[model samples]
Every structure is written in structure tokens, then in C-alpha cells.
Target: MIWKEARNLYVNKWILFEAIEAYSEDGKRIVKDLSVINAYDDGKEALKEYREKHKKDKSREMYVYHTKNDELIIEERMWMGVRKNG
Candidate 1:
């Protein structure tokens, strides 16, 4: 998974003062998104929940936390080709 966030921090009065003006014209600070990659089963479950929760969105976003074991599951949709070939 990849996430990003934006922050507002400045030093010089020139930059800071200019930023204040820009913020007033536009908007507030942006979110600073920090993301994590899960390698364990718990993380996979979290990903599952994320997928389910965001199901209603027109476009879904996902981070492939754990897919190898999922691919091995003998399910109808995914295993049909392998079974037929075998």
C-alpha cells in the first residue's frame, strides 16, 4: 500500500508569510498519510475489511498485502482453469 500526506511547515518569515497568504486564498493543511505493509494474517484480514468497507466506491483502491496464499485457495472463480487443465 502507498499513502502520502502534506504538511505545512516553514522557517523564514518570507516563506511563512507567503504560505499564510496562500492558505487564506486556497484552503487548510492537507493530510499527512503514512502507510504500512502487512505481512501477517491479521494484516490480510485488515485488507479484507478495507476492501469490503470501500466496496461502494465507484473506484476501489487497495494495497496487495497478502495475495499468494489467497491465490492458492481452491475457489470456483480462480481454480477452474487449473482444475480443468489438470
Candidate 2:
């Protein structure tokens, strides 16, 4: 997986981030992973390190997000289906 980072605007916190593949049918972006590798007080420094790691693996998916929380806020949703088989 790719390496990424996110910053908390209010608290001024930086965190490493990544996204994982999830099932999808249409052109809509689905589930993702916000795994926190580490946290930093300086956003610039955190981003600098994140860039270096990203450069190493350019083939993986990564993102840098600035949100209220340093980590990603995951929301659970129920999927509707036809039935369950034994």
C-alpha cells in the first residue's frame, strides 16, 4: 500500500495515512484505510517525510488530507442485498 499523511487543523496534528481496496461496482469511491503510521506536531515536517516515502513507492495509492481530526473518521454503513445462502 502507499503511504500518506493527514493534518488536524484545530489541534495541529499530523498523521500518516493510507487507503485499502474495498468492493465497488459503479464509478463511486468506496471504503478506504486511514491507518496511522505516526503523528507529528509539525505538518510541514510530517509532509516532508511523507513525500520521501511516497517517492520511494510511486505505484501505490496515497493521499494527504487536512481535516478536523488527525486520523480518518470512518463511518459504517449497511449494505442491502438479496439474500444469504447456507
- For lDDT, the strongest prediction is 2
Model 2 C-alpha lDDT per residue in residues 19-43, reported as the tens digit of each score: 5664344544343544655567677
Q: TM-scores for all candidates?
A: 0.24, 0.48
Writing each residue's lDDT as its tens digit, candidate 1 over 1-86 gives 11211111211111000111111112322212323322334554665656664575525322332332222111122224444453
Report every candidate's CA lDDT: 0.28, 0.54
After superposition, the stretches of candidate 2 with alpha carbons farther than 4 Å from their true spots are 1-12, 22-31, 67-86
* Candidate 1 residue spans exceeding 4 A from truth: 1-41, 66-86
Q: Give the least accurate 10-residue stretch of model 1, judged by summed lDDT.
A: 10-19
Flag clash pairs in model 1. Answer: 5-32, 5-33
